[model samples]
Target chain A: MLFSFLNKSVHLHGFFETDIYSDMQKPFYVKILLVATLLLGFNAFAQETDNSSAEENGSVKAEIKEFIAHHLLDSHDFTLYTIDEENNEHFGFPLPVILWDNGLKVFSSSKFDHGQAVAEVDGEHYALYHGKIVKTDAQGTINYDEEGHATNVKPLDFSITKNVVFIIVVSLLMIFMFSRMAKTYKGNMIPKGIGRALEPIILYIRDDIAIPNIGEKHYKKYMGYLLTVFFFIWIINLLGLSPLGVNVTNNIAVTFCLAMFTFFITAFTANKNYWKHIFWMPGVPVFMKIVLAPIELLGTLIKPFSLMIRLYANITAGHLILMSILGMMFIFKSWLGSSMSFVLASALSFLELLVAALQAYIFTMLSALYFGMAVEEPEDH
Target chain B: MEKLIEQFSFGLFFWQLLLLIILLVVLRKVAWKPILNAIDERESGIKNALEAAENAKKEMQNVTADSERLLQEARMERDSMIKEAREMKEKIVADAKELAQVEADNMISQAKTAIEGEKKAAVADIKNQVATLSLEIAEKVIKEKFSEEGKQLKLVEEMVSDIKLN
Candidate 1:
């Protein structure tokens, strides 16, 4: 959100082709006073709540947690923020709910009212239970397991949820961007727009990551997958930082799929030597090789597991820390404490940006390394 | 944590897998090929250009060295030719001087022989002329003395005495 505001205001005349050259010359900080007023109002509201009863403080903390949880979860509707305080009213749009309940049920997620009300379609009831649609009646009574797990029957949901929507949007965005970049390379001219930015990264992945890990002869065969994975993770991680509250990469399902893809590619491309080294140590004793063979096989499975967990944990922790610090401004209930929180939050936000790009690099580099290891030729000691 | 794990959906995996595969294929054809090919082409082109330049420079150096050697050989040849011609000229001048001295000596000897012959012949002719004059004088005296026997006897005795003194 800050980036969009900055891009729209101060740094409009950058290498980006957002508004074209005609709108290049524009003054900076047009909305500074407006932002100041908004912050002032928020501070005043925080003070008012501070002076209120202790009961209201508890509810405020609950509201903050609820907001953070909502931000973290994948929702069927796109809610930017809540507008009204009296009744639960969100200031965003709904998405198409694709479900396989009984038959193919298609409807707008606005019927769920941001998971407040239940949606009844064709004499069947559907309720949003913890960001998952489950079959329920009008009362929306949710059944739970002995361990408090939701035992509601869930259909194979193919809904274009907020996360999926962003995925598609981001996918099309990448497609359009790289495809246009490819077109410019037809001649010997430099990339015109985002291509200029992506060129260095592409070369970096090729030189620093792909070529060095995957050898000169075999690196070309795997560049396509490596490049795609790098951009895909990097872009989604960046989008997660935006005000849209997209936590796609922070989700395990997404990370798991990415790791699985890497695993599948590595397994499929592994040469005979890779298996030989894993199952049978050449120089070691035969008994020791047999003992270590299962561990080596387990290592193959663990590699992707660690890859999935690393990305999921890193991004999720970064978001949690950032949001928690921002939530502290209200919890602090004092100007000094709130200001300190604000500073700490700003610093963390900056770190998260770095972490965002770093995680992508780490993931892509490790994937390339694994690919290289798998296809390495057998050599004498 | 359990709740978070519950967020994973099988549908999402399939969807993401399908999407990523499609992305890989499309991007490889569209993006990676052109960018890489252009770089490779430019790189090799530069290498070829540099090699051509280096070869040309070497060839030029060889040609320059060859021309310098040929020029030096020609200069040496001209120097030797001049030296030989100068030596031959000195030899011819010395031989002509020796031949002129021999001719001068022969002419002087011939002139000396002719002068000596003329002097000897002139002396002989003078002696002959003197003998004839003396015989004529004696004959005239004998004729006068026969005409007068006593004067003849006196002249004969004087002639005999003068002859005895000679």
Candidate 2:
């Protein structure tokens, strides 16, 4: 009878263990792992298929060409692969839109797309395909709508991208908050309410970032840029967390634009002292100075380039790693393994959030430091 | 080369340039200006508030000093008034004592003069009475002696001579 009881208990334990495993399978981590494993399985399947297709064609190059033709630029179903959707259309081609008096009047993508749309109010010729507002007589000039109504001015066929919208909203929010803070200061009020919360951060930037990096006299000169950068990068990084998938910082082009702006500002704002330090070292040996000139000048250019690449690579790598981890879930056939992969991926995703903000702060801080360096006076020593 | 040149037209670049210019202009006018102005205004406000606080502190100090000065003056005035009262009482008491002394002196002098006049009158009366008595005595003795002594005529003549000499 004792032996039978022990056997019964062992059976019950087995059942309980199976139940626990089944319950654990439905967690978010499990889902992520499952999705990742599936993706990997699909990738393997595709690779096998590609090999078979290549064998049939007698060339791997032919298989690759076929794959590109079918996947990349195909116009079937009137669809385009775009990173962002705008104006109810995908951004497949580089296009320009005319914005005048805060009104979008015309948009155009490529010639094959919607070629142009004439303004219904005044019959003004608007090239919707290229986002250009044109007068009938002038090549690029815009003619006003005949109707006095402003809303009739339709946005060019193109719509604002998610990234652009995010940027604009964040910029407006920053402006509003800072303006309110200014009012609080004017009223001689202690930083109460939202102002109180932001006051410490602003002070930190001034005391910790601007003062230490830029030096006292020239810090004020770069304050505008520094504040702008800090807010801009922070806002973009935050938006990256949203479901909208705004990867502005990850986009090399966007980083390039930001880096370029900093470069131009530094280049234009550099005092003679900045250049003197680079081109001619006062205390260095003559031979060394000659050798250092080219390197120092090159460093100046490389500084901004590295800033761009650093921001882009870090953000892109974070996203890619997250996606890859998630993809591993589908690649694994075992439910346990997939679940574990998902848990790891989720943890990494949480870490990515912190990294995003940290990256923005680092970028802004470094940029401010560079600006400070560019404008700093040579030390007396 | 010609086809590639045709493909890559200047128009697209021109459009990009125009967009960039517009972006810069719009951003400068709308975004940068307001942001910078807000920052400047905030700084000025903070500075002004600090100055106002300093002014208020100085004003408070002045008011405290004024109150202290007024209190000191009041204390000094109270001390002086007390001193003046004490001095007045002393002077009045001195005057009263002096007037009493003068009245006593006048009464004493009047009594002494009356006493002197009365003594003089009494002395004159006493002298007159003494003279009368002496005369009476002399007359009686002469009458008695003359009746008894005819033989004493010569002595009477000598006595008359002595009386005239006395």
Candidate 3:
């Protein structure tokens, strides 16, 4: 509903050719929004009655902030939701925990009891505190220093956590899909089944993204990396938006790793002219080269740094805004105020879907652009 | 802020790096290489087919034009042959008529000369017959007169007495 105008303009450009909103009429939109408003109004009124016994409003607001922070963090177990809020009983499965302490130690994450209990393996004690596995005493006591940092001896964690499981799942899904699509090409030119849907997107990346940004001569070598990163980020972002509550790209550590790959690939594959341009630019005054060298060198590192933060902040901020607006439903006591928030939240969800695809495109485009620069041939004047 | 920073774990970063590397290597080998090659081959195939079709169309047009030229030449040849045949027939008919007229004139002149000769012969024969008959009659009369010669002497004496009296 919010992006109807944007869809119209994109349709006019003849890029997509099929506008998803072209068949929808205005009355149908009004009917859907109206029904949503009525449903949200009733739900909010009921919640207002339940929360009437609360002592202060400030405490509730603080709790909401803490809840958002916890939602953004990665965890040792895959907690789908809390069934009993008072008892703190969670409904989800536990993943396998691996650690590198004195030797190899492997155990199920259920031994920690959702971070309330410590796991004992071969006479060694370990506890998951703040989503970090640390060595502790038998009583699961964590000793903190003056700065509230855990002073306990920490072991290297190689556990298969929630995020790791999704990564594996998504990777396997991609391999299965594309390999099947590739198999259809053994005898026929056109792809079959799901490949029919995926062929155009793959072609788009090849024709529009890779060939244009990375020149034809060098684009073939980098095609594997470009395709892998584009689909990986795009699929991961879509999974984050699902109700499964898996936000892998929102983690700074994950984004840092992704950016590191792009940085290393560009650095390793750069030609002689690429480095020359940085240190000693051609057709410039001698003193100007000395002054510009340091800045150009720093620019290389800063490019990937920005890439890392851009993906991380964009996803994290989107999650923050959407959650906060939904949280407003509880704070607003009247039906009118709560219903308005519900409508805003619903509209923002559609926009987030577009941002998910856009972020993937931007990351891949910039990466290809950098690779183009690194391998560019020096032309004669 | 302190707790948020604390949530950044090195283990997660390590795991992510390992998984991504594995993914890139596997996908590059199994998926991208073959798919790209197939698409490229298909595109070139389409281009070749279009060129072949265009060449065939040009050949068809050339064949039609050749047939049309041959048909026009045959029609012109047929028209001139019919004209020559008509002229030959007219000359043969006129020659036959002139020969028949010359033959008729020769026969008529020959028949007229033969008729004239026969008429002259018939006239001469009639003249000879008439002359013979006249001569026979005169001779008979002269025979009769000589028989009367004795009386002629007596008469001569009478003629002499008449001459003496004058």
Q: After superposition, how far is residue B48 of candidate 3 from its true place, in Å?
A: 1.9
- Tens-digit lDDT track of model 3 for A1-381: 113323433443342133212222234335435654666656655567776534544566566666666777788898998888677699999999989988999889999988888899999999977778989999989999998888998898888888888888889999998999899999999989988988888888889998887788989988888888888888988898899868888887888898899999999999999899889987789998997788677777766766776787678777777776676666554486567778988887787788888888888988888888888889722
Off by over 4 Å in 1: A1-54, A189-193, B53-166
lDDT of 2 at B35: 43
lDDT winner, 2 or 3: 3
**Runs in model 2 lying further than 4 Å from the true structure:** A1-207, A219-221, A332-343, A379-381, B1-28, B118-166
DockQ ranking from best candidate downward: 3, 1, 2
Scanning candidate 2 chain A in windows of ten residues, the lowest lDDT window is A69-78
A14-50: candidate 2 lDDT, tens digit per residue: 5334432123223634664455555655455555656
Scored against the true structure, residue A300 in model 2 reaches a CA lDDT of 80
Error of 1 at A112 (Å): 1.3
For each candidate, the alpha-carbon lDDT, in order, equals: 0.79, 0.59, 0.79
- Candidate 3's TM-score reads 0.76
After best superposition, candidate 3 residue A165: deviation in angstroms?
A: 0.7
Tens digits of lDDT, candidate 1, A180-286: 88887777656777878888899899899999998898998888888888988989998898877688887778899899988999999999998998899678999
Alpha-carbon lDDT of model 3: 0.79
